[model samples]
Target: MKKVSFLLSASALSAIAVPALAQDVVFKPVVEARLRYETVDQAGPAPLTSSRDANAVTMRLRAGGEISKGPFAFLAEGEGTLAIDEDYNSGVNGKTLYPIVADPENVELNRLQLQYRTKPLIVTVGRQRINLDDQRFVGSVAWRQNEQTFDAVRVEYMGVKNLKVDVTYAISARTIWGIDGGKFGSANRPTQIDGDDVFANVSYKTKLGTLTGFAYLVDEDEAVVALRRNSSQTYGARFVGALPFTKKVKLSYLASYARQSDYATNPVHYSADYVAAELGLDVAAFKLTGGYELLGSDAGATGIAGGFAFQTPFATLHKFNGWADKFLATPGTGIQDYYAGIGYTVPKIGKAGPLVASFTFHHFSSDRLSIHYGDEYNAQVTMKLNKHLSALIKYADYERKGIASFTGDADTKKFWAQIDYAL
Candidate 1:
């Protein structure tokens, strides 16, 4: 009887042990490295020798890993950049002789997060990358070596078919410019409150398109007094969809509108509006697009110069305006941008998977005063060397025009060459 009892006990132990071992956690590694050379040449300053053209070569490296079991996972990442040529002013380092090169040398934590996901819900906590609505309002700023991240908790619910809801409450916005009061030494560099912000979005899909409504509320609390006064509330809606004109050709459109007003501790009491429209056509590997965007101004027009104008301080401003980045901040008179572009892709070229090229042109003007901001042209070529490797070359040129009511438009030229490896 004793032997039989022992045999049963052994069988039960094996059954439990096997299931426990199957639940072990597994880790996946994430690695990326890039080498880039950037050059900027500009003309038309009041003092010809105020700043010289800049040239710099830089490298970025990042590594991280994710561990997961069932519905729970954890991630940690580290990032660093090294400059081969320090001739350019990195917005830090005090090299004022050269034009600005925003890519500074630094090492810091990139992402660290805990996540839980189920069939209908997903939640993430800690510092992470967030991109919303084409990244117009917020994005990781991946072009820079030190990408931006957010220290916040995000939640998404998708239980209702065709409808989804997402929300984020962030205490801090980690910027690509790196941490403040540190090496770079700026209060808002590593963090931005956007006056204690909250973002909420809801979306529903239909045969016509996907429609989304959003609200972004910001309190006034920035390191810069002028910036702090920029605190406001924005409510908007967006629609994006594709129309199948034929089996081989398709048309796409995006339309958005928003209204902004002072909120929280902001002293500004003016109201402004925002509008955007775009249309595109796609056939095979070729694409063509045209777009127009406007940011309404308040007579009180652009605050930069003291006018009340619509502003998106927390937006991924680089993606819009133009490649020269002359309009990083909207002028006090408000702004309007008209643009067009074309792109093509060739597949299976020799050992490389594909090659892609694109060119775009933009015209800038003030919405309030009808002042011509300038004109810019941009072009890029990209090649996929392998599944995890790619190369790119990009160029941009901006023609002089009257901007900010200044003496004249500053003609600017820029070029970039980059190689990336990812896994």
Candidate 2:
């Protein structure tokens, strides 16, 4: 991994651009920094690497600015990460001996774009970051120091009351793992999606709640068979809302469903289904939720020539399934996750303002067949020291069960501590 000293340089570049383009444009500069320490411990017999523990401490810095001149504007940002200690295996580094730490060391362009805006419609071109809804399908993977950005063109329309429509066409996906074939790399090769990709989303906000409909047509680079399977088309609808039954209590619910099928040059002729539902209630400063999710299987596809499951290859997987990332890839037999969690926001203590804490549990099973996959528990605590600084502590543990008979996943545990400063 290469050490990057561009944080100062990026600031200099932003300073130069904002003034040079100040002819008539309104410009706002953006800068943020984060320092994190992460550790992982995993144990499994078959696929176990030589080292079961990993430790990494890293820092990320970003600088950029947004400029607007009338209805036309421009934005550019740069990102860099410096790793002080790298005792873990970064998949790309062939550090196969230790547990994996996906965060790599590198410097690169994060976002740059031009925009045209009107009262009813807006258009953007170049490389940018895009997030939809809760980021279940498409997201920037912001949890990682580095971000996921896309080279594309996007259009948004908000002419109608309570409704907005967004459409985008992307040529490539710049992953957080940085560029492919670099030191401290990730397991995902190419580190990008280089092909025709389209995303369409329509959302309506109502007095009752929010309703959304979406279609995602994703095509992968055909040059590699491994990447070809990622090509697929999905259509879905989601509903989320809250109801204030009483002044002291509020109830919320989320329900979603989507259908997926092979697309483009994918050899697979399989179709699968996805379903997610959750219900929650807020009492006082505490909230509790219960949910169930299913990733249906293509157990009988002849063209694909193998067991296939409904997959969200582009989703921010860490936010769902589990934090241990054991289910990053849905198993061929599919999966069912029954989960529940609780969250609390407490009064300030000392220098830290308020404190937020949450805990969640998940039970996993095979969706198609009857089999116990595993169980997991996760806990997190966050505190804001001030306006610009925040602290976090999180942990995850997964215990394996019988489903390993079909899925080659492992049991793992992880811990993370971090502090972020924004300016």
Candidate 3:
């Protein structure tokens, strides 16, 4: 025979090329880089250029890859941002007298997915990146610089045992101002928003910790008209925990609640509520915190200044109420925050890696309107300049009292410096 039929056809093509080279060795590659410097000093009223101060220099780049087999997996990502010294107003670059540095510039295609897993269940599809939990009403705003994504279809279920269940539906919603950001009634960056949105979450884990429940339904069409009056529907619950108070101490807590109304082609009918609570303590590395939050108010049907409130508009609102961001919307006479903090870590130098410092304070008011929208002070320092680098320096200050029937405005400050690298 012809050399024993060529060694049985080369062992059947090496058993199909060794399982496709072991599925390309489970490909994986994702990179990240960020560099930023921001500054803003506000006191309000600068109709396009009287100078309220603003200085921004940004850079962000993300690239991606992911692959798998045996349950399927795939991912793709791309993001970019560049604005070297834009001197403010990046709300799609109108440069309105400086101030709002919403990080514009552009590049897109951030995340393309496909997944499937098992053990309980899991599934994902299309453009992704949905951050629930602590995102405080869904997120991915990722502190601007072009983030926020969706275009979904997601699912998860953890077959009980500590539980977990997630769901998503989405149709569009991909804003952070990239790719020339504009469309859908653009007044300043809209970059896609076609909605049908839906999200759900369920969590469980115990021993005094974890517990969640959520629901969100946001619907929009054509767009504009203030995002179709920001169509809404929400429901929530949260609980977080920690306890050990000894052996170096520990105690942490959080509680949350939510409620909202008006949905589908909303034309304003109103109903709102939201609340939060927090407490923390650590010891050993020192840490302390206190918090309270509320965002309720809604007096529709001719109640004057009460069309709506309790909005999140896809949160990550600069991590909440004031980073000098001065309430990223949610004040149709609603908002009440009171906060406190303290932190410290340091104690890892040599090869460089850990370091932290913090301070915070905030007090804002107005829920049903007694006004008093001000008082803030924050500071930070962070570092982890090692395995892939990290660094940050931040500050924020806000002071504006508002009393005579809400006069709030003027007095604000912000600053930041950051660097990051990852792979």
- Of candidates 3 and 2, the better by lDDT: 2
Per-candidate local distance difference test: 0.78, 0.82, 0.79
Best-to-worst order by TM-score is 2, 1, 3
lDDT of 1 by residue, 1-423 (tens): 243234334433433343354568777898999999999887775653337789989999999988777777677799988999877877666676776677888788888777778989998777778888788776788887778877777899999999999898766666666643224444434333433678888999999899999998876466566666668899999999999988869999999999998888777678888999999999988999999999888886334355777878667777897877777666667789999999998988998968999999999888876788788999999999999999999998988675335422578898999999999
> Candidate 2, residues 1-423: lDDT per residue as tens digits?
010123224333544554465487687898999999999887776666345488989999999988777676678899998878888775665777788777878688898777778999998777778988988888888888778888777899999999999999877788777754334433345566677889999999988789999999999864766578878999999999999988858999999999999999787778999999999999988999999999998878655544788888778889998898888788888889999999998868886678999999999998776878899999999999988999999999999885354433667889999999988
lDDT of 2 at 329: 81
- My TM-score estimates for the predictions, one after another, are 0.89, 0.91, 0.32
> On residues 1-423, what C-alpha lDDT tens digit does candidate 3 reach at each position?
232233223333433443474645477899998999999887744332236588899999999877766766667789989888888878766666677778887888887766778889988777778989888777898877789987777899999899999999877777787766663334535777776879898999999999988889998664456677667899988999999969888999999888988889877778888999999998989999999999898866233455468777777788987787768777688889999999998779788858999998988888874778778999999989888988999999988774322323567788999898998
Candidate 3 residue spans exceeding 4 A from truth: 1-68, 74-76, 89-97, 104-116, 123-128, 133-135, 142-145, 148-273, 276-293, 296-314, 318-325, 329-365, 372-423
Off by over 4 Å in 2: 1-24, 181-187, 303-306, 403-408
Number of backbone clashes in candidate 3: 1
